[model samples]
Target: MSTHLLSRHSHRPRASLSLLTRGAAITPAITLERGRAHEACGPARRSFALWLAASTQGPVLWITPQWQPVTLNPDGMMDFADPARFLFVAAPRREDQLWAIEEALRSGAAPLVVADLEEPPAMTPVRRLHLAAEQGGSLGVAPLALLLTPGSGGAAGIESRWHMSPAHQGRQRIWQLDRLRARTQPPACWRLQQKAPRSGLQLCPAPQADLPSEGPHLRATQQ
Candidate 1:
């Protein structure tokens, strides 16, 4: 028999085109899984920042825009003991009030500033606050502002944003903490009660397994 010329392409197995396409489809899912895993591993940036501000034993400025004639007694003061220092400012008007608050924040006299106003602040104002905090070497605790409204308008400088809400009461006058916004971590809810026998308010623990049962009872009314 006459020998046929061997074809160069005959011997090699065909490459799997389907395998390449399948790997391409799997890449995005793998990336998403890794992202979720990272989020689960760390404490939310906002919550951690709030905790730091609350724990700081320095001067703090509290701005209450909605309620007038607000006062903080020694006991009420102790409730926010983490931010050990404070200055209470009540502003009724938006324009005038924000300006005054901004001035105080820029002063750097206080390490923390809290604004409880009716409307969420604009992005520019929030950015200013961030810059002020950075320059002053302080933290700002804006529980109300961050909660009730859209903080989208605020400046891009905010390190973290948190949404905190009041939880139910326990045996004493303990309040629960609900977190609505925590960028890097999953949302968390917990209870924090204080014992203030000397200050007149009592501390009570929630009826949860992790919480302890031995604390003074908080009176129904604020002293």
Candidate 2:
């Protein structure tokens, strides 16, 4: 019975291996998936975006609300990326911020675009972004889009969602990358170690052995 079932299942098609991030063969491709998006939040969002920026080519378009309580310092960002490659747009209102993100994705001039938000945008705006990214917008590859929110992100209708928190130990600046939501993969976690003096992003698979007998507490991941 098992052999027969296996034979029947072997006919199904499989997705190709295409990765945009540093590691993980199981992570989904960040290309041409309409009506889906990626999200990350918490204190590690800036460093995560900056780490992503280094892996891609072309300019990065950054959008934020003018009234946003926090600011992006070019001097600090230059430590991970070239500040000159970033085009900052301050949207005076929430609607304008969504519009800016939509237009930037539709233009495809940037290889990556990061939007810093006080809270998650509505589902409609998220759908528009997914559509624009899938259409390719006259570029060879669809531009990657990331939304940064405060607290654990709860972006509606996204392809994948992640939560990052600082877990520094001694002189090392370490971070925990939690894969909150994904369509095809199970929840995962990683330890990101930032090597000093420009060694770049270093990723390590966070061991699952430390999880409790009941399993890892998931409350912190999907928030």
Candidate 3:
């Protein structure tokens, strides 16, 4: 067989997954590269992870500390992703939780693996996850591992870092999404809104500060 024909017949996995599609000419869709580890922080990090899972087709492996009292509410997940599609792995220790995440990515058994950690992990483990994901790609599908950290996540050596927080109004479903850091993109913020339950997500640039260019310069006189 010719080299060209052989290449054409080969299976090619998607390089990235899109979370939010482009809105008009504002910006291109939000995407996370496959076979890499990314970070999501802030108050709505879990929701952010769900958005990513919604865009992919496969079982989702969610790892959280078994001791943590908080649990995912299926009723609340309906709007984002089907709860049935998730497989929960509760690790009793922090180290165990990360270990599970690394193994899951290396196996390529699930396209998405989420690790809910109380604190950000150091660069060492993050690098391991990245390598694991890369190895998994060769096995079959390239898994995307998401690290959910509290507050402003500071996970090192990640492909990207995203922060999301609720910014809702009376009845409007709104959230502020910020791309804090990325390997190839600059920092940017956006207002994400879901007009209706099934309407889908919409994005708009975050509103600029309303303050004047120069705050009234106060003149002080000797008293």
Measured against the true structure, the TM-scores of the candidates, in listed sequence, are: 0.48, 0.75, 0.83
Arrange candidates, best TM-score first.
3, 2, 1
User: What would the per-residue lDDT of candidate 1 be over residues 77-157, giving only the tens digit for each residue?
Assistant: 334343245565667677766675566656656544555455555667766654544444333332112212323222232
For model 2, the superposed segments whose C-alpha errors exceed 4 Å read 1-36, 204-223
Please say which candidate is ahead in lDDT: 1 or 3.
3
Q: What local distance difference test score does each model get?
A: 0.37, 0.67, 0.81
Query: Considering summed lDDT, which 10 consecutive residues are worst modelled in model 3?
Result: 211-220
| Candidate 3 lDDT tens digits, 1-223 | 6455444466664598777743433464577899999999987888888888888888999998887767777767877878899999989899999999999999999999999899999999999999999988996769999999988999999999999877765556777888999997789888887776534578744542221111111122332
Considering every candidate listed, which one attains the maximal lDDT?
A: 3
lDDT measured at residue 197 in model 2 versus the true structure, 0 to 100? 36
Cα distance off (Å), candidate 3, residue 40: 0.4
Model 3 error, position 189 (Å):
0.9
